[model samples]
Target: RTRMGQNQTSIKKEKLDDLGNKTHFTQKQLKELNKQFRKESPSGTISQDEFNEAMNLMGVVDPFLQNLVFKVFDKSKTGTITFSDFVNGLSIMTKGTQEEKLKFAFEMYDLDESGYISKEEMTKILESFYKLIGPSDDNPLATFSGKKYDAPQQLVDEIFEQMDVSGDGKISLAEYQEGAIKNPDIIQGLKLFSES
Candidate 1:
């Protein structure tokens, strides 16, 4: 049994090494990268130097509507973003008939159909968003601007709590619509689509 255990551990270690090679970043390297990122964007506000630094850090890549995304997520005047902020940004970016989109989002987030989105409901929504946006094994987002990824779970919870203004544990269609309109990306997308 001891030998078998050792063999299993070795196999797992080998697999981890293989993944590291494929991803081209060791755990320490990843930590350093994240540290560097935080050092640069600690307050979330983009300085010109930071902007240029990010360009260099992330490498040349296609713009994935990042400026619009940053504008939407930088809520609370905080320099750093949480997961909730990211999803709220996505909610705003989603396009459709305003009423329809709001209704759908509210329904999806309102797990209990209590006509409001609770923290639990919002977590699920954020998870869904991560699944939608996270780097897939087959294809990944361009490595520009550090690749816009899904929000962290804790951040998602915070965002849900903040958005539920009435404390009713749910967000109504009106609230959702209002939030959506506040998002510049969604508004721009809607406007461009309308014009086209």
Candidate 2:
């Protein structure tokens, strides 16, 4: 059993090399990445608890986004993220093909995994950004009349108009691709490619 596990890790290392070549990360970089991953995930996979720790290390305060990131890396739909999947998932956002990056972003925003990023989810994500930047009076999440908001309806409307091509309240994967293509800043700001 131990030998089988070792072989799997070795096979994963070979795949990681292929991934690194495509992403321009040399063997040394891949080695360092694996080292760091092992520091946090010595078993070659990271469970939800370990993922939370990693998120905390990244100074990620929002639980929602943290979980979304975990989901992205757990491509096998398993509860934990293996080292190979972790490296591959990181590449998807940082230097993978355009389609891979867009697919990742789509999953990132689709908090519910409902196959679409609903207007409510969009509003929540936008509100989270405002919170991170220190909300001002104009920010949707700011208390209005000494009370929290039920929803940021206006912000959702504006976002829908910009990206919801089918007049649906949610953004589908197709709509997300078109919107990202239309707004280069979305790609650049999100670091969807190494060039950005």
Candidate 3:
């Protein structure tokens, strides 16, 4: 029985080491993250509804943004997030480089994985954003800034006019990278994921 227990311990350690190799987190960090994930999802997988509840607890209350994030994290398209998926996606959002994060951000907008962001795609994302941060009496821009806010369509047109350098009517990945690097505000505006 002691030998069997030792074998089980070694197997668990091996699994953690494997995940450590795949993610940016250390073994200890992975363990902690897994503990948190399991605490939230005891079945070792999180359904979309559970994910939405967790995001709401994290203060991410925008249903549209929450849905987009869940779609991005559910890479396997199984409509559920496993521990591995959660860790890998969290690693990218928390520890990935600027370009890597931008790539993930681009994926959120690309929608069809077509390697480019069409105007319609951008419009959908921005419309969701506008729903969250749209003009309101509490919005400073609507109050003190005294600046006219562009509608979602106008915003998408302005973004394409600036980022679609190839004039191909689509914003390619390269154009997105360049535009994001040049305008930090663009990255801020595309804040579906928390960079912190």
Overall lDDT per candidate, in order of appearance: 0.47, 0.72, 0.79
Candidate 2 lDDT over residue span 80-175, tens digit each:
998767877777766677777888878877988999999878777766655554545544343332344444566566557778999867899999
The TM-score of predicted model 3 comes to 0.82
* TM values, all candidates: 0.35, 0.74, 0.82
Q: Model 1: how far is 185 from its true place, Å? A: 5.3
| Candidate 1 lDDT by residue in tens digits, 45-149 | 454344434534544122322332343344554654543343333334343456544554455456565766666666664454444345443222211122333
Reference-based TM-score, model 1: 0.35
Candidate number with greatest TM-score? 3
The deviation in Å at residue 18 for candidate 3 is: 3.5
lDDT of 3 at 47: 96
Best lDDT among the predictions, by candidate number: 3
* Candidate 3: tens digits of C-alpha lDDT, residues 1-196: 9999999999989988988998899998999998998887899999999999988887677887787788788989999999888987888888876777788888888888898999999888877766766766543222212334557686677678879999999999899999878766666544446542
The model with the greater lDDT, 1 or 2, is 2
Question: Residue 21 error for model 1, in Å?
Answer: 57
